[model samples]
Target: MTFTDDLKKENEDIFQMIFDHPFVQGIGKGELPKEAVEHYIKADFEFLNAFIQVYSLALSKSVNREDMAYFHEQIQFTLYDEVKPHLNFSEYIGVRFEDLQGHPLPPSGDHYIKHMLYHANMGTLAETLGALLPCPWTYLEIGQKLINKYQPTKEHPFYKWMHFYAESGKETEEMRKRLDVLAANSPVDEQNRIKDAFRKSCQLELAFWEMSLTCETWSGELAVIK
Candidate 1:
C-alpha cells in the first residue's frame, strides 16, 4: 500500500467520525443550518486565503518543471474556480465578501492554516504535500459518499458544494499523483514525518468541522458572569 493508503488505514476511525459528524450528515440530508453554513464560509474563506500562500510556497520548493506547472495550475484553480464560487455563495447567503474577509479566523481554522503553512514553508515538498492532502482527499471521500446516498435537487443547499468534490476533477487527480511521487521518492525516515503531517492534518480537518458545527468564535462578549 502507498503511504496515502497507509495513512487512511491508520486513521480509519477518525475518517469514520468525520463522515458521521453532524456537519457532514447535515450536508447529506440538506438540513444544515444556514447560520452554521455561513459561519463555515467565513472561516473557510480565511483558510483558502492562507492555502493559496501555501501553494505559492510549494511552487517555490518544486524542483521539477511538471511539479511547478501543477502547483501553478492548482493556485489558479483555488483562486478562480474554488474561491469564486464560494464568494458567490456567501453573497447568496447575505454575506458580503468584505465581511468574510474582515472576520477573524476561529481557533480551529487558525491552527489548521498555521500547520499547513509551517510545513509548506519549513518542511520538504513531501511534507508540504502531506500536510495539504487531507483537505481534498477527505472532501472527495465524503463527497462521493454523500452523492451516492443523496441525490441533491436544485433546491438543495449544499448541491454545488457536494458536486465540487464529488466529481474528483483533474486538479484532485493531479494532487494525488504528486503525493504518490513525493512518497515514492522520500526516504524511510522522511516517510514518518510525512505520515505524521498527514495524520495531524486529518485531525485538524475534524476540528474544522467541529468549529463550523458549533459556530465557534474568538469573542468573549457572550461569556456568562457567575
Candidate 2:
C-alpha cells in the first residue's frame, strides 16, 4: 500500500470518530440546528481564508515547477470549488458571503489553522502536505460515504453540500496520490514529522465538527477584536 494509505490505516479510529461525529450525523440527517449551521458556515469562511494562506506559503516553498503548479492549483481550488458551498449556504441564511469573510474563527478553527500554518512556516513541503491533505481527504471520504449511505437527494437539506464534496472526491484522490509521492521521497526523520502532522490534523478534524455542533465561541472576551 502507498504511504498515504498507510497513514490512513493507522488512523482508522480517528476516521471512524469523525464519521460518527454527531455534527456530521446531524448534517446527514438534516436535523442540525439552523443556528449551529450558521455559526459553522461563518467559521468555515475564516478557515478557508487561512487555508489559502498556508497554500500560498507552500507555493512559495516549492522546489520545482510541478510542486509550484500543484500548490497554485490548490489555492484556486479552495477559492472557487470550496468557496461555492460557503457562498450558497450564506445566501440560504440571508447573510452576505462577503460579510462572513472576516468573522472570528471559533476555538477549534483557530487551532486548526494555526496547526496548518505552523507546518507551512517551519516544515518541509512533505510536512505541509501532511498538514494540508487531511482537510480535503477526510471531507472527500465523508462525502463519498454519505452519498453511498444516504443517496442524498434534492429534498435533503444539505444535499448540495454533501454532493459537492462527493463529486470532489476524484480531485481529492489526486491530492493524496501527490502527497504519497512526496512522502515516499522524503527522509526518515521528515517522514516521522509528517506522520505526526497528519495525525494531529485528523484529530483536529474531529474537533472542528465538535466545535460546529456546539457552536463554539470565545468564552470570556478578547480585549482587541478581529
For all the candidates, what are their Cα RMSDs to the real structure? 3.1, 2.6
* Model 2 lDDT per residue over 1-226, tens place: 9999899998999999999998888767767766666788878888988999999998998889988898898889988888777765665566776765777888899999999999999998889889988888888878888888888789886788888887787677877887888888899999999999999999999999888878787889542211
Q: Against the true structure, what is each candidate's TM-score? A: 0.91, 0.92
**How displaced is residue 8 in candidate 2, in Å?**
0.6
Candidate 1 minimal-lDDT segment of 10 residues: 217-226
Candidate 1 RMSD to the real structure: 3.1
Model 1, stretches more than 4 Å misplaced?
84-92, 219-226
What shift in Å separates residue 82 of candidate 1 from its native position after superposition?
Answer: 1.1
lDDT of 1 by residue, 1-226 (tens): 7667787899888888889999998988977666777778878888988889999999999888988998898888777777654764565577676666646788899999999998998899989998998888888889889888897876777788788878765666677677887889889888999988888999999999998888887767341111
Name the lDDT value of residue 195 in candidate 2: 95
Model 2, residue 219: displacement in angstroms?
A: 2.6
